[model samples]
Target: MVIFGLTAVVVVGGGAFVAKRSYDNSKIVPTPITPEDFGKIALGDLYAPDPKADAYKAAAVTAYKKDKLKNARKGVAALDWIEIKDKGPGGDGFPQANFPPGSNPSPGSNKGVAKTMLSSFGFGAEQWGCLEKLWMKESGWNERAMNRYSGAYGIPQSLPGSKMASAGSDWQTNAATQIKWGLGYIKGRYGTPCGAWGHSQAKGWY
Candidate 1:
């Protein structure tokens, strides 16, 4: 009987020892949390700084401020006063001398009329290019051109066509009259032909 009791105690103790060993082997040990690891976990890679990109941005800002200061020091001239009078041809105020002598473009050809009129609006040859492109896309320079969908008409494609009457009573039949109104409109709305053309290019209309 005593031998059997001793054998049972040894078996129980051995099973407990084996169970404890298994538990210890299966247990997961936690890794030590370092400061760097905590930073990565909380803020991710955002904690890292890009010195080159920061330097470039700082340089760009400094350059922009310097340029602004230079421009401020170099005072800008006011734009030349433009007077829209009713003394010239078609009762539009632009002076006759503004039109280059012998610039009588062929009747019904709107481009020649526009080129002659550009000087009156303070535009140069460079502006003529932009005006040409703008009108070509709008009406192909055809004085009678009409958009059936939008009801815009004339070489300038003035909406309702009557707006050109502000320049002359012959707005419908006269390319010169239409061109005058168109130039006025461009100056008022866009400041220049290139400005109008740029807007047209971006939005498919001016």
Candidate 2:
């Protein structure tokens, strides 16, 4: 009877040790995403002023990669929204579009506008050609173009649309607003239009 009691204690102690080890390992790694958490998700572009959005997105993507979520669009949308929102008027060190009253006219076409901005960026024809191709593929230089799948809108394809308001109040209707934002994005992210084009080519999206 004493031997049997000793054997039962060993079994229980071994089980307890294994359970404790699993709990410790879980704390070191990311918490496994569960179906309940997945059900709470409904993806949409968030405005940038919300400081917690990036961290949320990062966690969501991490969970998605772990096969806990249905799609990574939730994560991609998170990144796109913030990038565009940072260009908004008064967005932390970015230029605000403060055109003299009526100095900025509505664009009838985006023709020549992109080229002018390209030159201003110190990019020559080689860079211009790449940018032209890149934008053409992304939105055909259409200020009003919107991606139905990702909710990205405008020439630079700023997610959530409102983020372009930093470039101008007339973001929705103005070609120049979109171009300005797009140029800023290229300069910041890739250092040059060709660089962005290269990334787009390799990644299937810039």
Candidate 3:
């Protein structure tokens, strides 16, 4: 996930090359990746594949989409879990659903989940209005967004959605999960949805 105040400068030159290589080594894109495959998934690899990203992304998206389609109705109902108004200090969940990992929920799911999650955090539409436009413009709400050049990926276009875990552990295709982290990011850095929206409008990021 993108952090505040800076554009990514992939520092792979000179001495950083070794470190970069090490980081690269942690990535692994699995083929025929089943939902079972996710248990062992390297979220880093899934979000930012290596040189063969085109093919890898296609397969990843296909597999994930199929999985969602299979559980579409159930996942749709899962939206019920997202309640508005932060459930206090630890929030709705702690080390569990509070922050899942690399699971990119469908864009439509993301919206529904956001509404639910944000509401749970004591927020109303006034807080979400600008954010709605920010991502609508960035990915058109596409959870699988991948920049051909920069390789930014997923709903938040986290460049490498793996970084989203820092907001919590949930990173899969769970929109409520992603929205939780995204809202946290906005609050931590910019303090409000409209603030983050303004920054993105001015600097091409949010």
- Number of the top TM-score candidate: 2
Question: How do the residues 1-206 of candidate 3 rate in per-residue lDDT, one tens digit apiece?
Answer: 22211112222222232234235533533234355434434342232323343333333333333334546756652111111211111111222123234443366767877777776655678977887887775555655454332334445555345445544454534445456666665666667778878976765555
Query: Could you tell me how far off, in angstroms, the CA of residue 185 lies in candidate 2 after the best superposition?
Result: 0.5
How do the candidates rank by lDDT, highest first? Answer: 1, 2, 3
Worst 10 residues of 2 by lDDT: 79-88
For candidate 2, write residues 44-146 as lDDT tens digits: 1122233232222232223223332323535533222212221223222233334344433323357478877777766777787788788776666766565
The local lDDT score (0 to 100) that residue 93 gets in candidate 3 is 22
RMSD in Å for all candidates: 36.4, 18.3, 15.4
Residues 1-206 of candidate 1 have per-residue lDDT tens digits of: 54344334334443342344336433535345467644543442321333432332233233333444545567754211111212122112211123334443243467888999999988888898899998887777766565432335667666445556567656656678889888877887788999989987875556
* lDDT values, one for every candidate: 0.56, 0.53, 0.47
Candidate structures ordered by TM-score, highest first: 2, 1, 3
Candidate 1 deviant stretches above 4 angstroms: 1-108
Clashing pairs in 2: 88-166, 89-166
Candidate scoring better on lDDT of 1 and 3? 1
Model 2, global lDDT = 0.53
